[model samples]
Target: MRVLVTGAQGQVGYELLQRVPDGFAVFGYGSQDLDISNADQVRAVFKAVKPELVINAAAYTAVDKAESDAERAYAVNSDGVGLLAAAAENLGIPLLHISTDYVFSGDGDKPYTPEDVTHPTGVYGLSKLAGEKQLSEQCSRHLVLRTSWVFGAHGNNFVKTMLRLGSDRDTLSIVADQHGGPTSAGSIAETLWALASVFRRDGRLGWGVYHYSGAPACSWYDFAKEIFTQAADLGLLEKSPNVNAITTAEYPTPAKRPMWSVLDCEKLVDAHGLVPKNWVQELQTVLRQLGERQSV
Candidate 1:
């Protein structure tokens, strides 16, 4: 099957391009190649590619920046997604889009399900939620995978930031109050491919919004400790830095981060027979890749 993927240079998008299974033809476009927010660009690309499936990995992901740049964020996250959804709808194909855990208010103590009432706290979350709504409304066949704390070898993320800091400093401070799954971009790409494969075989999916993230949710502080431990073990760092646990109040940002971003992924497992991978194992793989890159 021929597939079109947007945001080809992004973490998950890069992984999707690399891990295309046998018997599938994939075309990937970065922002310079195809601007999904532009209706003409969207129409032209869809007309040219005529893909059997469309996976939207493009998003305005500057969480804190979104506060000052809501218009751009909505253009990419909200309007871009709507355009892709409309294109897919026109072609009568499936559009699989990625979303975030920030759509919630982050006040709850329990893990979030897809059915939970959404109350985004900031511009970023509000914009993403708008995108989700656009996809649902515009496309008949679509899947929205709401994930969190995505990191991978290919892009800027918390893991890479931690690794950079760990190597440079003797100590580092991380927020302990906020918690969520540290999902790997590779894992997310794999999940999207699995869903694509199922659609290829069955011609339909248990379509709708579903929560899929890494196993064993953790705080930023816990995530940093793991990163340091794993980096030291891999010889990526001379030594693990002293990770200082700090509360969210200690470190403020323009965008309010969700204090609790844990997602319950049982719905996805039940529907698709897929399970979230252990983030520690995923992190090890990522660090190994980074280690290889450093040597080169």
Candidate 2:
């Protein structure tokens, strides 16, 4: 399979490139190499690559920045996805798209199912929801995998941020009111590949919106505490910082974060025999990788 992945420099994008299985040819492009928001660029890349499968990792992921930069957010998150769908549809191929948990209003208590009513409270979430709609409307064969709280060794994420803060500050304050699973980028990339392999064998997938996040949801405070513990154990941190639990009001941002971002991944498991990985274990792997990178 000739798979073309956008946002190649991103957390998940880098993993997608690195973990290409045998019998598959993967081509990855960063924002500079292939600007997904540009129609001409997207069309030209698709034409040149002649990809049999298209996995769109490109997105405007700056949540707080998207509040003030709605146009750019929609351009990449909404318009860019639509363009990819059009290109992939024209080629008669499957378009695998990544979406976020922010599509919800953050008021719900239980895990969000794929069929839950979407009510995004911020511009970023609104833009991503629009992208999901665009993909469904523009392409016939597509899978919109919605994930939450993505962190990884390859790019900027909560894990790296916490590690940086933990090393510099004696005490770190994290929002405890907000809760969600801290998904690993490598795990997400592998999940996409597993679907790609299935599609290669069967020539089709269950094909729809599905949720795949880390298991056992936790708050930002909880996530930070774990990061410090694992990082210190791995000798990545000199000493664990004192993590303080704080409310959302204590740390304000431009965008409204989901109070509850836990996603129900049963649909994916039932359809594809895929389940979410334990994030605590995944965190250990990430810390080890970060340690290796630091050594180099």
Candidate 3:
């Protein structure tokens, strides 16, 4: 099977490149290789590859910047996804699109199900929600996987930022009010591979919106503390900082974040028979990789 992975240099795409299963011909492309925002470019790449499956990991991911650059965000997240969905629909291939938990308004304490209403609070979330709507309307065979708090070895993420800050600063303050699962890009990529394998065998294995993330919800403060603790255990940190917990208002950004963006993974678990590892365990593995790379 031929699989095309977009945003190949991003965290999730990078992990996908490393974890591609055997018997599959994978073609990974970064934004420079094929910018999804350009319709012609997207079409040209799809025509050349003619992939059996397409996994779109590209997006305008800068949450705070999106506030000032709404146009670019919509062009990339919404229109770019529309182009891919159209191509996949024309080719009769299944398209797997990655989404985020930010699509919901984050008003409640309970986990959000797939059927929950989406009232995005920021430009980034609104753009992503538009993409999801387009995919549902334009493509029949597509899987939109919604995840949260993604971090991995490749690309800039919370884990790397926390490691850097913890090493440089004597003390750091993080928001404790915002709660969500910290998913590893490696885990999300592996789950996508499992779903793609099923699609390759039979084109009908429950194709729709699904939520998947690390087990056990946590706040940003808890996540940072865990990252520092793991880094110290792996001997990656020179000195750990005193991480203080604060409310979301204290640590403000340009965009408003969901206070409770945790997604329920029951649908994914029931259909794909998959459950992500705990966030702390994933953090340890990432720190271990970082240490190994530094040593080498």
Candidate 4:
């Protein structure tokens, strides 16, 4: 089976490129390789590649910048996805598209299920929601996998930011009000590749909206504390610095995040029988890959 992946340089896409699944031929494409929003370009690529499966990791992920660049965000996140869905539908193949937890309003006390009502507070989330709608309307065989707080060794992410700051400074301030899982791109890539393998073997899999994130829910402050704690334990940090927890009010940004974007994985569990993995373990691997020493 041949798979076409978009946003090849991104956190998730890079993982897919680095560790492709067994018994499959994969072609990874970045924005330069294929402009998803361009209908002609999308059609041409799909025709040439003739892939059995398409995984769309391409997205305009600048959460705050989306507030100012709404047009660009929608172009890539919404319209771009629509083009991919159309091409996939035309090819009569499955399309696995990535989404985000920001689609939810984030005010819920409990975890969000796949069937929960969506009310995005920011342009980024709203645009992603638009992309999800495009898939539902355009493609018959599709998987909209919504993930949260994604971090990886290959790209810029919260974990890398913390590592850089913590290594040089004695203190870091992070927001405590928001809560969600800090999922690793490695985990997402692993699961997607597994799904691709199964789908290739069976030629079909029950497809729809699914949520997969890390095991435990935590605030940015909690995530940072964990990063520093694990980094120190792994001898990756020069010093155990202070992690000052503050409310969202203390940290102002262009985008307003969901206070509780935690997603319930029960539906995904019932569908795929895959369980969430802990991020701390993944973090250790990422830090080590980044040249951090393992504690003796």
Candidates' RMSD to native? 0.6, 0.7, 0.8, 2.0
Residue lDDT tens for model 2, 1-296 = 89999999998999999899887999999999899999999999998999999999999999999999999999999999999999999999999999999999989999999999999999999999999999999999999999999999988998888888888999988899998988999999999999999999999899999999998999989999999999999998899999889999989899999899999999999998899999999998988988999999
**Candidate-wise lDDT, in order:** 0.95, 0.94, 0.92, 0.90
Q: After superposition, how far is residue 236 of candidate 1 from its true place, in Å?
A: 0.7
**Colliding pairs, model 3:** none
The list of candidate 2 runs beyond 4 A from truth reads none
Query: What tens-digit string does per-residue lDDT give for candidate 4 at 62-82?
Result: 999999999999999999999
For candidate 1, the 10 contiguous residues with the lowest summed lDDT are 159-168
Q: lDDT (0-100) at residue 293 of candidate 3?
A: 87
Q: Candidate 4, clashing residue pairs?
A: none
Better of 3 and 4 by lDDT: 3
**C-alpha lDDT of candidate 1 relative to the true structure:** 0.95
Provide the global lDDT of candidate 3 against the true structure. 0.92
lDDT of 4 at 53: 96
Query: In terms of lDDT, which candidate is strongest?
Result: 1
Listed in order, each prediction's TM-score against the native is 0.99, 0.99, 0.98, 0.96
The candidate with the higher TM-score, 2 or 4, is 2
